[model samples]
Target: MYTREETIRRMNGLGRAGAPFFFVISHDLEHNLLFERKDGGQGRSAAFSLPLGERGGLRDCPPLPEQIRFDPVPCPLSRYAAAFSSVRAHLLRGDSYLLNLCVATPVKTNLTLPHLFRFARAPYRMLLGPDASVSGVHGRACACFSPEPFVRVRGREIATFPMKGTADAATPEARRWLEEDEKENRESATIVDLMRNDLSMVASRVRVKRYRYISPVETRGGTILQCSSEICGALPENWPSRLGEIMMALLPAGSVTGAPKEATCRAIAEAEDMERGFYTGIFGFFNGRDLDSAVAIRFMEEDGANLVYKSGGGITVMSRMEEEYREAIAKVYVPFDL
Candidate 1:
């Protein structure tokens, strides 16, 4: 693992840019080491792409309000099947419990691809610019974001949203509907419990301020429903110094991974066929007093000359393979709104 100092130095080397670049924090199972990389200077070469264009919706589209065009390159299913069986065996042996198994789907689209337009239109949505890229590895596309704390410094306050569940959101009340959904509830609880433990590690006191809160994001794939639980705690005066450690303690965000973190991570190593690269790492910027970062999801990496978007959902013992398969496919998008 790159030392906290090393990670910060890399960021500083990028100079002042539009935003802090993408970062990937990955632990190699075989090597048992952590890796960090700044996005390097690849942002200048990066050509953004989105599915939505001048064309309003695709012609002859479904009536579903959340429906959108999704196209991905064909990938071999045999590979994913083998990996799933391996993970299932581990679960059966009790080596690991819940794991988020994933695979990459190389994609191509005939529809309009949004690049310069995204920055021109929605500036906040643009994560990285000229210096935007993963932190540890060079010349790689990765997704990373801040944890989005709801508290500010100089006070005795803290809040974190432990995002956990996902569902289809094609309805007008997508957020409200998902808030009461059972499947989402169970998943959010597991991660909320995990986050509470995480906060307790470095917090003076912790509390579950809210439970089963919902957020909806419109993507090219459709309206993805996400459920999160808010937890708060009291931090020490020296909390800023240990912020890196606190974030590291929550490595491989529980929401993206699964419950019983360690074992589940092991299962991911055994079950996941392709290298995750920077898919689930966290990245953000801190100006000393406060820090912000994001769990690297909604990410795309290049496989040779082709771009492959990586996405998947957490799996429990209750997870169905068919449903999981659909979720994996549903994640590929160019960040287009339906």
Candidate 2:
């Protein structure tokens, strides 16, 4: 658990030496830890699973035990409505165009962090160490198996895949509907614009290379189709040496936070009223040359003797309370095969 200043310094030093390492930062810009590569990407506090190839492949993970199990308690609609109302008020007052609202729902799962680390079918996954109290990691046992990538850098080219707006893939013409729906389009467009602006802060010739691309997410509950876009920018030739400054400028990721990032974060605090911990933070690996990272969504943590999964959706002036509540709840399933 290093301070931001220390984390930046450590990251920059690694960059200068071209050392491969792993890093994680929380939503509040508070807790950040950078672990230099030790024994082929084994940090003292965590084991990593990342997709480094064209396909979502990863290092060897343990085989699953039989009887995969997962069941999440539904969050009361009333609680979600209250939070939605709070955020919507901010929107109505012109505080922000979009604000992402998240919630913690206790899930009944006969699975452990190790089990998830082994079997959860996600490209970017992590299992926090020896125990939760291990400092930089969450204070409770936790693991994140996130489908959304925050950023990727190769040579002088850096790109972000901003995921927003989800539709039930089970529905007829869902992909077409997600692309055509005004609200969903607006949400995805806002995030794409925000990410483009963020990248321009440290790069040149930023542009949206892809818009409203569809990616299907499979869960134990069902299939969810998500909309995302690719925004790319040209970084300096020495970008690796200044990786810390670049990362600090581009995160906690516009897709998770929202447009007008600063104010929206404050609005999120007032509405969420609880620490996000690492749920929406960014974590990544720098493989000495190229880098890749994932937004810390699709997250779960151990709470005392129980397991809690954190999930949420973006809210806009055009958002509906009932629909948004259902979206948040629908995001709660573990990434498991039937």
Model 2, span 83-120: residue lDDT tens: 89999999999999999999999988778777776678
Q: Please, what is the whole-model Cα lDDT of each candidate in the order they appear? A: 0.53, 0.82
Q: What ranges in model 2 sit over 4 Å off?
A: 39-45, 53-65, 132-138
Total residue pair clashes for candidate 1? 18
Instruction: Write down the TM-score of every candidate.
Output: 0.71, 0.93
Best by lDDT: 2
- Misplaced by over 4 Å in model 1 are 1-24, 27-70, 74-77, 109-139, 143-156, 171-183
Clashes per candidate, residues 3 or more apart or on different chains:
18, 0
Q: What is the number of residue pairs that collide in model 2?
A: 0
**Over the stretch 16-103, how does candidate 1's per-residue lDDT look in tens digits?**
2223223335533111111122433333433222211111112332333233334686455666667767777876777655567777
